[model samples]
Target: MRFEIIGNIINIETIAVGSSIREVERLRKTYGSGRWRKLKGTGTIQLDDGTICEAELHWYEAHGIGKKEIKIKFILSE
Candidate 1:
């Protein structure tokens, strides 16, 4: 879903890294290579419908490629 992070993400943690990431190959092909990591964090987000909620977010990132394919794993609160 389309949304914007309202503030900083907290409790950030790496779920996977490099070759361990299931989508590493696709990530590299689409975004170029670096050190890809799959990470998750909790933060407040404003959805396209204008609903604000707390959510868990997951995405892939590399040193210079930045965050990619961010998705909400689930909503924590409304």
Candidate 2:
């Protein structure tokens, strides 16, 4: 799993792996039209070990039909 946030740019990647999550909040400041897609938000991730972390999430994707790539970014863990 990887998370990074630089100003308006954000990136995050994660897999189920050994860690398990119970709940996820929501995202804000989201905007996208009929073309490019973009969104920004914050959420909480709980691990199987009961470790709680706060994260900022972001996603971006181009309009198409095949093999779309999604980029996510998380930051500030507690």
State which candidate has the highest TM-score: 1
Candidate 2, lDDT over the whole model: 0.40
- TM-score, cand. 1 vs. native: 0.96
Show where candidate 1 strays beyond 4 Å: none
Q: Please state the error at residue 47 of candidate 2 in Å.
A: 4.4
Question: Residues 1-78, candidate 1, lDDT per residue (tens digit)?
Answer: 799999999999999989999888988899998999999999999999999999999989899889898899999999
- Each model's TM-score? 0.96, 0.34
lDDT per residue for candidate 2 within 1-78, as digits (tens), equals: 543333433343433211131111111123322233344556665545666666666544334421123333544677
Clash list (residue pairs), candidate 2: 11-72, 11-73, 12-72, 12-73
Off by over 4 Å in 2: 2-34, 47-50, 61-72
